[model samples]
Target: MEREKIKRIVSKHRHEKAAILAILHEIQEEDKQLETESLNYIAQLLKIPVANVYGLATFYSAFSLGKKGDTKIRVCSGISCHINGADEVNEALKSKFNLEMGETTWDEKFSLEKVHCLGLCSIGPNVAFNLVTYPKLNKERIETIIEILHKRTGDSK
Candidate 1:
C-alpha cells in the first residue's frame, strides 16, 4: 500500500488509541504484516514517533513484521498428537505445500507452524487453521483443506 494511503488511514485515528489499533488491525488483516513502510507512514501521519508503531507491533503476536499468509496452519506436536502421527501429517502438509515449518509460502496461501496443542488430544494428529481444528488428519486431507481455505478467502494460492 502507498505511504500516503497509510498516512491518511492513520491520520483518521487522531487521539483515539483504540482507533489507531483498529486501523493497524485492518491493515494487517489485509496485508498480514505491518511493514516498516506502514509503520513509518502511520508515525508520520499520526504525529507519533516511528518507535511507537514499531513498539506496538512488537508487543502483539497478532502483528507480524515478517511474512504472513492468508491462512495460518498450526499442527499439533504434543505427545498425544505425536503418537497419533502428527509428524506424518506435518510432513504431508510440508511436502504437499512445499513449505518449511514457521514459514509462509511465496503465494501467501498458507503459513505452517507446530503449535504446542490445540487441547483436543483425543483427536490426535490434529491440524488447525485459524483455530478450526481437524483431527486424525492425513495426506489426503491437505488438498481439500487448502482448497476450503482458499475458497473462503477467495485466494487461488
Candidate 2:
C-alpha cells in the first residue's frame, strides 16, 4: 500500500532535478512522518543515494523523522508571546493534552511542540494547531478549542 503511494508521488515529480524536497513533503503529509523504508524506496525510484534523501529529511525542521500524531500543536514562546501569556497557554495545553513540548499524546491524536515565533507578534500568545495560527489566546480559549477538536473527532477523552 505504502509502496504504491511512494511510486505515485515520485512519478508525479519525475522530470524535476530537485524534486526531492517536494517528494519528501508530499510523503510526510500523507504518512505524518518519513519512514526509513519509504525513504529507501524513494531513493531507489529516484536513482539517488538514500543518504541524500535522509540528509534532507534530517536537515529540515519541517520534516519529522519519527512518527507524529494526527494533530500538531505549536506554541510560540517568542518574547512577544511570552509577554502576552504564552506560558500560561502552553501550560494549559500541557494540562489538557498531558503532553510536553515535543511529545505526543498516547492516543496519537495530538503532538505538542514549542516554536520560537509565528510572526504574529502583534497578536501575541499565538498557537498553531495543525498549522493554523490562533493569535491572542489565553488558557480558557485554548482549552475550549481542544475540546472542540476532540468533540469533532468523536473522541470523548
Candidate 3:
C-alpha cells in the first residue's frame, strides 16, 4: 500500500524536487500521517536524503508521524481564542471524549489536537472537526458536536 501510494504521488508530481511538499501532502492525505517507510520510499524516489525527508516532515505541523483517527479535531489556541476561553472549550472536549491533546480515542473514531490558529480570529475559540470550522465554541456546543460525530460515525459511545 505504501509503495503504491508513493508511486502515484511521484508520478503525479513528475518526480520534480519542487513538488516535494505537494507530494508529501498527498501522501499524508491518503495515509492520515506519514510513516517512516513511506518517508524512506519518498526519499529514494526523489533521490534526496532520508534526513531531508524526515526534516521536512517533522518541521511541518501539517504532517503527523503517528497514526491519526478518522475524525481529526483541532482547537485553536491563538491569542484571540485563548482570551476568549479556548481552554474551557478544550477541557470540555477532552472530558467529553476522554481524550487529551494529540490523542486519538481508543476506538480510533476521533483525534484531538491543539493548533496555534485557524486563521479566523474574529470568530475566536474556533474548533475544527475534519477541517470543518466551528466558531465561538462553548461547552454545550462541544457536546453537541461530539454527539453528532458519534452518530455520524455510527459509534454508540
Candidate 4:
C-alpha cells in the first residue's frame, strides 16, 4: 500500500488510546496483511519501538505478517471434532489444495489452518470456510465444499 495511506491511517489514531491496535487493524483492512516496512514506518511515526509494533502483529492471530490467500480454511481440531474425523477432513483439504497447515496455496487462492474449536461439538469435524462453518464433515462432504470453493474462485481445479 502507499506510504501516504498508511501515514494517514496512523495519523488518524496517533492521539487515541491503544492507537497501535487501531492502526494495525486499518492497515490489515486495507492491505489484507501487514508488511514489515509499513510496521517500521508506523513505529517510527509513533515514536515507539519497532519490536513493539512487530510484536503486536505477531501476537494476534487476526494479524497476518505476509500476504494471505483469498480464501482461508480453518479446520477444527477440538477433542470432539478430532474424535469425529477432523484429521481425515484436514487430510482431504491438504490433498486437494496441496497445502499443509499454516500454509497458503501457490496460487494464493486458499490457505489452510487448524484451529481449536468452533463451539459446536455435536457437529463434529467442523470446518470454517472463510466465515461460514461446515459441520459433520467427511471426505465426500469436504470434496463438494472444495468444488464450490474452487468454482467461486474461478479455478477449474
Which candidate leads in lDDT?
Answer: 3
Off by over 4 Å in 1: 3-15, 18-22, 78-83, 119-121, 130-132, 143-157
Error of 2 at 93 (Å): 1.2
The digit string of per-residue lDDT tens for model 3 on 81-123 reads 9999898899998888888899887777788898998899999
lDDT of each residue in 97-133, candidate 1, tens digit only: 6888878988786888777878998877888886578
Minimum summed lDDT over a 10-residue window in model 1 is located at: 9-18
Report lDDT (CA) for all predictions. Answer: 0.77, 0.85, 0.87, 0.84
Model 3 pairs whose backbones collide: none
Better of 1 and 3 by TM-score: 3
The sequence of per-residue lDDT tens digits that candidate 4 reaches over residues 1-157 is 7889988887788534377888888888678689999888888888888999999999987778877677778889999998888888999999988888888877777778888888999988899877889998999999999988788787723
Best by TM-score: 3
Give per-residue CA lDDT, model 2, range 1-157, as digits (tens). Answer: 2999989988999736498889888998889889999988988998889999899999987788877788888889999999988889999999888777887777777888888788899998999988688888999999899889988865623
Model 2 lDDT-worst window of ten: 148-157
Residue 1: error of model 3 in Å?
A: 3.9
TM-score of 4: 0.86
